[model samples]
Target: MIELGVLFGLLAAAVLALIFVLLRRGNGSTENADGLLVEQARRLQAHNDRVSYNAASVRSSSPTTTDHYRP
Candidate 1:
């Protein structure tokens, strides 16, 4: 029972150490967040523009009347 307790303590300490290391390494990645945001914004704008253009074309080509056999 003592050996099992020691093994569990060692495993818990190793896991905590690993988590601390990963958090420290992840702290340096905040510098590129602005660039990523700008890129994502540009992509969103382009997609919105394409959607608006398609919507306009569809609106212009659509029929205003309900009668399909008249035209």
Candidate 2:
């Protein structure tokens, strides 16, 4: 039973080490990171603009408070 526990502990440690190395290797350069962030920001802005335009259109098409009160 003790040997089994030790084996599992070593396996877990090896997995953690692999994960750490892969993460470090995948980080890439700062310029690439900056570009990715900029692209993400642009996409976010476009999404926000589209949502705002759609919300405005919906608001314009809907009935007004005065119309509701009259009805």
Q: Which digits, one per residue and each the tens of the lDDT, describe model 1 over residues 1-71?
A: 99999999999999999999998887455576898898899999999888778734756544553544565
Question: On residues 1-71, what C-alpha lDDT tens digit does candidate 2 reach at each position?
Answer: 99999999999999999999998889566655778899899999999888777734756654433443345
Error of 1 at 12 (Å): 0.2
Off by over 4 Å in 2: 27-71
Q: Which 10 consecutive positions of candidate 1 have the poorest summed lDDT?
A: 60-69
Report, for every candidate in turn, its global Cα lDDT versus the true structure: 0.80, 0.80
Tell me which residue pairs clash in candidate 2.
Answer: none
Off by over 4 Å in 1: 27-71
**Which pairs clash in the backbone of model 1?**
none
